[model samples]
Target: MLLITCPECGARPETEFVCGGETHITRPGPFAEVPADVWAGYLFHQANPRGKLRERWRHQAGCGLWFNLVRDTVTHEITSVYRMGDPKPEIA
Candidate 1:
């Protein structure tokens, strides 16, 4: 099983956390001002890179804190785990 380390609670079972999808996505704009297509793209578009990716995860079964993680999709290896507001780390 994959192991995930929670920033607030330390290492825990993967089941304790829920993947919150890709991070650093900004909202399109004021609702009515944004074209429907742009808004739709913002809501639905997600990059599914084959290699390393940055994502958000919430430790629901532990401290209930959300954090960011850089992981490899191919091998399921996590490179870094950090608090939500912190800048994403530079992975080698």
Candidate 2:
């Protein structure tokens, strides 16, 4: 069982949150001008990192706010959690 630290409601079970995929994704400016392969890559490609990774998460059962989570993919340990618009603190 993994404990997810909710930015608004403190630490809670991982079940209370939902994974919302990568955080920093930008859409192509001109849809028609974008190549087929580029569009496909943007839609389908994702990095499944092993160590600490930055991901977007939503507290579905808690305060219901979307936030950034820096977690360890290997052990499912959350290193840091913060709101999307807030500045991330220095991690030791």
Candidate 3:
């Protein structure tokens, strides 16, 4: 299992956290103006890239804070973890 490090807490087991799916998802738009297809895409579509990807994760069994993590999908190597509002870091 992965040993994810929380910004607030120290390194913890992957079982203590929960993956919240892909990060940086842009909302389609104002609900009243967005078309049905676009809205559906925003709600259902996700980029399951095979290489490096940014994802949202929560420390469910610990401090219970949300954060962003950059990890390699193929290798499961986490390069960095940052807070929710921080800009995404450049990872080679």
Candidate 4:
């Protein structure tokens, strides 16, 4: 089982959090001016790399705060977790 640590609630089971998908995806400019293709890509596309990937998650059952994590997709290992506005933690 994946053990996810909620920054506010301390260590907890992964079941307590809900993943919000890849992190660091910047939304395109004003929606009214963005082209259809660009908008579609922005909404549906995400990088699905096999190695290290960044993701966002909400501590649904705990503090309900959103946070970020740097994880290894293949090994299901989370290298680091940090607050939403804080700089991402670097893996040593």
Q: Give RMSD to native, each candidate.
A: 1.1, 2.1, 1.1, 1.4
Runs with alpha carbons beyond 4 Å of true place in candidate 2? 88-92
Assess every candidate by TM-score: 0.93, 0.84, 0.92, 0.93
- Candidate 2 local lDDT, 1-92, one digit each (tens): 88888878988888998999866678775998999999988888977777777789999998998999888788877878889987765534
Candidate 4 or 2, higher TM-score: 4
Per-candidate local distance difference test: 0.90, 0.83, 0.92, 0.89
Model 1 weakest lDDT span, ten residues long: 83-92
- Model 3: lowest-lDDT 10 consecutive positions: 22-31
Candidate 1 lDDT over 1-92, as tens digits, reads 99999987888989999999999898877887999989878888888899899999999998899899999999999999888789888856
Candidate 4: tens digits of C-alpha lDDT, residues 1-92: 89998888888999999999999888999888999999989888888999899999999988899999998999999989988888876654
lDDT of 3 by residue, 1-92 (tens): 78999999989999999999989888877789999999888878888888889999999999999999999999999999999999998856
Candidate 1 displacement at residue 84 in angstroms: 1.2
For model 3 the TM-score comes to: 0.92
Positional deviation of residue 9's Cα in model 1 after best superposition, in angstroms: 0.8
Model 1, residue 57: what's the lDDT?
96
Which of the two candidates, 2 or 3, achieves a greater lDDT against the reference?
3
Top-scoring candidate (lDDT): 3
Best by TM-score: 1
**Model 3 Cα RMSD, Å?**
1.1
